[model samples]
Target: MTATPGTLVLAGTPIGDLADAPPRLATELASADVVAAEDTRRLHRLTQALGVRPAGRVVSYFEGNETARTPELVEALAGGARVLLVTDAGMPSVSDPGYRLVAAAVERDIKVTAVPGPSAVLTALALSGLPVDRFCFEGFPPRKAGERLSRLKEVAGERRTLVYFEAPHRLDDTLAAMAEVFGPDRRAAVCRELTKTYEEIKRGPLGDLAVWAADGVRGEITVVVEGAPDPTPGDLDAGELVRRVRVREEAGERRKEAIAAVAAQAGLPKREVFDAVVAAKNAAHGAPSEGKGLT
Candidate 1:
């Protein structure tokens, strides 16, 4: 005889304040048939603080062992055991672990659902002065400088606000790189500590933020960068395109690369931009003395 399948619960825990822990989370913790937590010790502390006792088994489900433990959790679900998945903070499977188990559960046609709670991404975006009507979450940047810069370059022309998760220690270097690629004047926000007592939010140009972060930052970090500004009338004129390409070339980008980047940024075809630059040079034109688009 086949056993009844159980529900897979993806619960979001408080990022900082314990009071933010939802009552539903408490009830779920107390009654779940199996609790799969990213950190068993942290889970213990949380349960203690909440004054709740689990009626079923509790197991560690983190990055290290998630691969091997997913099947076991799936079996529990298949056996009709209520499996509750919770991360250290925020929602599971978001720059955290839980993807494997959730995917397995879905493959088996087991019911999967989430208990909505506090989110760092949305919170930071809301606090950020930049526009958030359209945005994208770019998880962590690559650790290496070259790779990180390449990744940044890929989105250089992105018009939607960008959100990123970065380690505190690497904040300065990351901001510096962003300033280089995204321009020193690009606006951004640095959200730290979140809902904790020491929570802090820093908003300014990327260049200024880089200098501030150089002094050192602590706790969790989320960065929100304003998207590339929209081009205005005459923004794509031949003189404007030449100036844009030259600025990039002066920044050490190859001529070809600079032309391509300028094209993308101005929403123009590369051939048109390249021809414009060639035409400007042939006409003995140097950088524009003054123009609405030069800055």
Candidate 2:
């Protein structure tokens, strides 16, 4: 007879305050047969803080060795080992490690569960004062300036509130890029060191935030920016509509979907945006006007 596969627990660690740790986290940690941690040293601190010693072996499972370590963890889980996975902060696999291990365990028919706990994303969003009804969590912007700007441009017309994580060193540059791409007057909030002693939430326009960050900021940062304003049909000219469609296409979006998205943003019918794109294509080819059906 085959042994039952052990469970895989994805535990959420506090972003800053140790008190934010969930009650179940300690129980799971103490009972787990194997504990995979992003940083072993941090794990030691956390276990000490909770005053609960892990009953099983602890191993490092971070980005550096996530790929190599995933198979090993899965094998242990297959052998009926209750494995607990934890990151330094927040939940694992949200711009962190543990995705590989979770996926592998699931593929092997192992039970995978999560311990609901603190999240910097939700915490920052709630404190942002921006629209929490609709939002998107954009993990982190690219490191390179050109790539970062390109990434920002792709979502320049996003209607949902945007959230992003940024390193302290790059916060200024990132905000500057956002000011340029999303416009200087766009309202935004910068959450620093959430739930920690030095926690700060700066709310202002993108331009102001950029200027403030120029002087320097510290701690883990989460930025929340207001969504793009919905423009009326008359607000966007045919050339601008075509340009928006082209931008989306360049960003790997299907032309049809791109046209529909631009139409929604401009609050116009999809047919209108499709016509504009068709007209622009014909004009670029120097072709005479011929009524073309929307594809």
Candidate 3:
């Protein structure tokens, strides 16, 4: 006879204030048969703060060993061990290290559940004063400058609000890149040390925020950027379209990407924008127009 598959519990830890830890988190931490933590030291501090001692074995399950340890944890689940996974703060898988274990557990038909607690994503979004009805959590931008700019460009025309997790040190460069790609006038919010004693939410245009972060920011950071604004009908003229494309190109975007981004912002077809750009170029170079003009 096969043994009953055990459950995998993903518990959310407090982002800052220990008081934010949910009661269910402590109970699960105390009762789980096996506890996996991103940082064993932090986990010890957490348990101590909550006055809960694990009745089961505790182990480290961080980025370095996540791959190797996943199978071992999965095997334990198959053998009916209750495994609880927790990160240093917030949910395990959101820019953290629980995705592999969760995916592995799901593959083995193991029961998986979550103890929802404080979330930096939602907290920052709520405090951002930006549209929260529709949004996407982009996690973290690429660390390298070129990759980071490329990533920002991909979302240059996203209609829904965007949320991202970034390290304190890179906040300035990231915000500057955002300003360049999303436009300096785009509204955004930077949430720092969320739920902590020094919690701060800086709200302003991307250009201003970029300047503000130049002096450096400290603590956990969550950035909320307003979505691309819908262009008015009057704003879709041929000259305007061409100018928008040029702006992107000037900011290091490829001509193709610039055209696509302009098209997305105008809610027009790419072909239409391409034709407008072609017509503008033809007119400038004293050549005959090869395509239809902007309507």
Alpha carbon deviation, residue 43, candidate 3 (Å): 0.8
**Predicted candidate 2 versus true structure: per-residue lDDT over 134-252, tens digit per residue:** 99999999999999998898788788999999999999999999999999999999999999999999999999999999999989999999999988678879987888899889879
Q: Model 3 misses residue 264 by how many Å?
A: 7.1
- Please provide, for model 3 over 154-227, each residue's C-alpha lDDT reduced to its tens digit, 9 standing for 90 to 100: 67767899999999999999999999999999999999999999999999999999999999899999999999
Alpha carbon lDDT at 91, candidate 2? 94
Candidate 2: regions farther than 4 A off? 237-240, 246-254, 280-291
What ranges in model 3 sit over 4 Å off?
A: 232-265, 269-295
lDDT of 1: 0.89
- State model 3's lDDT: 0.92
Give TM-scores for every candidate, taking all chains together and pairing residue i with residue i.
Answer: 0.81, 0.93, 0.83
Compared with the true structure, the alpha-carbon lDDT of candidate 2 equals: 0.93
Worst 10 residues of 1 by lDDT: 286-295
- Residue 73, model 3: lDDT of 96
Question: Can you tell me which runs of candidate 1 are displaced by over 4 Å?
Answer: 232-265, 269-295
